[model samples]
Target: MLLTRTNPVIKPRTLTSIHEQLRDHGVNLFHTQMHEREAFKAMFSFGGTLETLDRAQVNNIDKAILNARDFASEVVDILKAAQNAEGEGAHLAATSAPMTSSKVA
Candidate 1:
């Protein structure tokens, strides 16, 4: 089975900003406190370390993966909504403006 991993391209600052924006919009998402420890260990550990992990440790990693996936999905949805809203606003502005023509006789 292929497990989906969250893309690591997002910088920490951008991630924090996303989190804050979500919070400001009353969207509660990306609770890092739940999987923070497990994620930290996973980042610092060697490739073969999973084999040595206990059941609980493995479970923690699993939860972290799920959380990461959920967080990423929510971020994508939020960005898409923002993009659509901007497009609508631009369309509305263009349509509401008065049309003027300059003619020389």
Candidate 2:
């Protein structure tokens, strides 16, 4: 229903205009440090996890890891909310059902 995040990078100059256009359409964008960072790519290119990566080679490695943790936490919260809503919907449907009977000989 809404656009939350964007691709690898939207460019500094174009971000403002894009954000404004999306907002006019009732769409919100979530900007996170983990969205586009060199540290993330370095982890893959160097063949190692965030912790195992060499801080000297990758700038802002620590910040990138922290952002990743935060992003993951946000995802978990969203999933939990969706699950709760689904359960409530199911409960309502079950309670609103009509009773039916069949005759047998």
Against the unseen true structure, what C-alpha lDDT does each candidate score? 0.59, 0.72
lDDT of 1 by residue, 20-76 (tens): 777888875544333344553655563444335565544565565566576667678
Once all C-alphas are superposed, what RMSD does model 2 give against the true structure?
4.1
lDDT of 1: 0.59
Candidate 2 at 27: error in angstroms? 3.4
TM-score of each: 0.52, 0.72
Q: Over the stretch 1-105, how does candidate 2's per-residue lDDT look in tens digits? A: 223333444546576687688779987445443456677888779988988888889888887787788877877877899999999999999999897677786
49: Cα error in model 1, Å: 13
Worst 10 residues of 1 by lDDT: 1-10
Off by over 4 Å in 1: 1-34, 47-59
Model 2 pairs in collision: none
